[model samples]
Target: MIDLLKAKKLIFLLVIVISSFLIITGCGRDSGADIQSAEDNSFIMNTLVQMRAHGENAEIAVEESMDRIREIEYLMSRTLEASEVSQINDNPGEFIEISEETQKVIAESLYFAELSSGKFDPSIGPIVDLWGIGTEEARVPSQAEIEEVLEFVDYNNLEIEDNRARVTKEGVKIDLGGIAKGYAADEVREIVKKHDVPSAFINIGGNVLVVGNNVDGSKWRIGIQDPRRGRGNVMAIVESKDQTIVTSGDYERYFEEDGEHYHHIFDPESGYPARTGLLSVTIITDLSLDADALSTIAYVKGLEAGMKFVEDIADVDAMFITEELDVHLSSGLTGIVEITGPDFNLIEGENFAD
Candidate 1:
């Protein structure tokens, strides 16, 4: 996630997608317009989510959107003992009744799990808790420990039917952190749509979605994070209009122990941080959920395979940042993605598979 407010001495954490704005203005926008924006941030889904809407009822829309996100967090948060996910995990083999929202997220997650050949497994909760990459207790687990957890990390074993979900294996757990934000962002879109907002940007912990254009009618500039450089240092910029930009990267949400860095994104097969040789994978598309799932799937697939995975999908494009700081784009993203960081070489037209 990016820290857009870092320069302001306040870290507005979100995934690495930077909301493009003018630095000269205090709030990072061209603010001479008669139109105004209503923005608010709340801690939900374990991230500081912020939404800015421009319209007559922008305030009401933003407030309602936050409430919607809170509801989602209550239903799906794995850490919450009373959450539906925890209820399912706490009681295996028993179908716990869930809201359609939870069912949709799980169902969508399972679809991606199958599509990525379990690379984006929803039943990877045990492995995630073991590594604790995003937690203060983050550390590398032993081979035996990881092996033991792997037995319970099968997404195929997750069953869902009639607005309920369950796991066949006792130790299996479901964590929607991988994709819940995207679903929430889409929900926010609906909230703004109902209010008929002219334009908006939803930054749910760095998974960004822009509705329409800026107040000044300029395409929103989204900055892609540079892996080598820390947050706030942009690798590239994508001029977007009404689209979702989600990136899964190894840069943040990781811990270093003994010179080995373990990231939050785990490879289900190995039960370890994904060593895909690519620093990050970004998916740009209409739906935030699709972009969210695909970004993780592509990162787990690595550079060559990741590029192919994005290319095969219609109406979707992706950018791959390599370990060598090389920026690779899918055929669809070739001309549109602008390289802003001089250190990064835009390696377009090169055969990645070879």
Candidate 2:
């Protein structure tokens, strides 16, 4: 599991102050609460600050949210020794009986695979292991080797019957690195809401889920990072209320060898880093899991087709940053999204506001 304080520190710079408002969630709350009177309580959990404010019971809410996140890590994390997911990967083809919570996440993952037409597959562990971006042994695997492993990378081979999940393939593994954080963020949001936190931001790594409207009830102005720049340099900002923002990029985790650039996002079919013209894809939605899944799906689908995918999903918006340093906003996100900074050239699509 990630050290909570250290993880929070890495992602804290991503938050930019737009406006202030109290975000409310959880069970107990006074009928009348003042924004100035609300308390901001924070704790380290699942690699980020699980924070919330309830003019009422602030401390307990923060604790509960953090606790839930820790429990989730036990279910979904690969780093944890006793994690159900880790156990499944350790002993492939063995039926791993999972908790109801684990079952639900697996179901959701399968659903996302179907929705994105396998572009957002969860059975990507073969490709992930080959690249080994998070390990010291990261390298560009040969095309022949990648293709050999691709045979075991199909989601249809993942069997979920009743409370048990079995990998039919002999060597395939499952990694939820992209979607689990968003699900955790959503869970934290629900927990705080149950405790009556008026408004808050639960950011697990770079995945952010808004607790409520800002303290003033306007919206949170989230700055989208410039992939080519250092910390705090933003290409654009979006106005959001009770929403989640998730971005997947080549630059997030990657290795360069000779003249070839290899990144974490992989194409299951090709078993190589996706050749998406976009350097990154940022997804905005009410659900963090959806945001996380789509951020990855868009990167795999490339700029043109990915934009259309966002359009197909109702109430979902996205920003695509191409290798050319151009930014493209989904039609539904155009009016509400703003571009800033000097390095990016903003282009409008004919269907930008569709």
Candidate 3:
């Protein structure tokens, strides 16, 4: 009788293991079946825009998404003479009518600006231009030069109403560089959804937005870029479906002069690159636009305050990598984030629960 009972327990354990395996391998999908995907890439928005879809209309959807991205870039680019942002910047103190799309992005930027208490200011164009971090003319601006440009960096000075935006202060410029790519990713996701693509991913300059799971119906794996390493080096990986992942790092756009590095992200108050005790901040959420702006805000807020800020928000999780190579994740991401790099250590008990 005892032998029979032991045999039954062994069989039940086997059944549980097999069931778990089936669930993890994905339900109803042939494990060996090939998942066809169509991909396209274009250099736009000052970075490479890539899209991949796994439906019958994958090619068409990718092409349409690319076109939409270009349209957004054309409309929002601050340097483009015909762009709405440029017009508003060129005509400070004068109201300029912009397209509905431009108005939407500007409105969203203003919302984030208020939410982050102006940490993610849209009116940072003048300071960005003075630093010129990403351009061939990039250089560290003098203290006086930065101060001169910083006087015009207040987001509250910009006004938006009825599809018209105007800068109340002369020399105040609006650059959508901080949040435009996320908005573009959101736009591309809409385009993909309109085409009824079942599984698609839109990557606009590393701001990734997914319409669904991977082609194989598994969770999409996204890598958090290692700030200290070159491109493609990741410190950790996160798995998700139907989420947007964005990273704001000091390493993305910067130039070194006199043994000091100056990155693109600047502190609106100090008129200099934000020294927020963070090397990079990555945000994952349902909205690409929110993730984009929040990543920058978290980085500027520093680690302790930034982690708390992200925890207070609903339906959002973040990974903050400090300059000391310590990784801090939101409570929601404690179990979901897997550290893969040896150089970084995950801070225990640092996650805040949802």
Candidate 4:
């Protein structure tokens, strides 16, 4: 009878051990699945701003990041009467007090204008307003009108001191449309970091800034938009981490008239849409602001010069899609870029080194 009792006691302890092991294993699986993902979006900066994050307070972090974007839009938009940009534009000849954000943006704009030799100018506002390419009133402006506004499109006429800015030329206006979204992306990144988010990404109308790697600690795959195809159609893919990707394409903001497509990217010299022999230019860099401004500058520089320009810059990679659907990538992106669409031919940029 004692021997029988010993056997039963051993069985009971074995059962308890098995049950504990199963419970622990089940909790381990649940912990892996508990990594939550949250996403939120808002329409701001004249584009759709999206935020995706993975963490404990991801929802709250996304909400706060979007609020920061809206605040930037309100401060920088030229259409808003009370915006600092409008205030500077409304009083062109006089020094007007502006916010610190406005001052910083203007300062950065001037730097880029000098860097690109005026290829990316903030003083092209008058010309942009005349064409109104993205607005309902978009129409072809006459050559006479173009020439008249061309005089007021010089970036050198603008001056900044402390928190004040002045446009020496009368009727000269400043527009932040080209670089504002990029700045807003940087701001969103800061907020996400403050929330201790391990991984996050912000897409402000295709100006994407990835905060870190994927949840699995892998690189994020970013698609290069096919300029000729519809939205979400990509010609190639770029895998990266903690980078900003900005693309300037003819198809992004354009209007069709008489079978000719006129895009929003204008030449400061011609006061007309740039005919740069390229369909789109994508810039990848550490800062979204640099990527944003460089994409426009490279698009304006055309294919040959654009390729050289990107190669000369440090810590910058670019992908150029030509009119013939040829894909060209900078030296930095030679091995990293993969052509996904069969319609496009890959013309490696390393072959063009001078």
- Candidates in order, TM-scores: namely 0.92, 0.85, 0.89, 0.89
* Error at 115, model 2, angstroms: 2.1
As for candidate 1, its clashing pairs are 1-14, 1-15, 1-16, 2-15, 14-205, 14-206, 15-205, 15-206
Per-model RMSD to reference: 3.8, 5.4, 13.1, 16.3
Best by lDDT: 1
- For candidate 1, write residues 214-322 as lDDT tens digits: 7667777888877776556776888888899998888657767777777888899999899978888888999999988999999999988887777788999888888
Best candidate per TM-score, number?
1
lDDT of 2 by residue, 38-81 (tens): 32323233343435444466567666777787788878876677
Q: Is candidate 1 or candidate 3 better by lDDT?
A: 1
Off by over 4 Å in 3: 1-36, 351-354
| Ranked candidates (lDDT, high to low) | 1, 4, 3, 2
TM-score: model 2 vs. ground truth: 0.85
**Global lDDT scores for all candidate models:** 0.83, 0.74, 0.82, 0.82
Clashing residue pairs, backbone N/CA/C < 3 A, model 3? none
Of candidates 3 and 2, the better by lDDT:
3
Off by over 4 Å in 4: 1-32, 349-353
Which parts of model 2 are misplaced by more than 4 Å? 1-54, 352-354
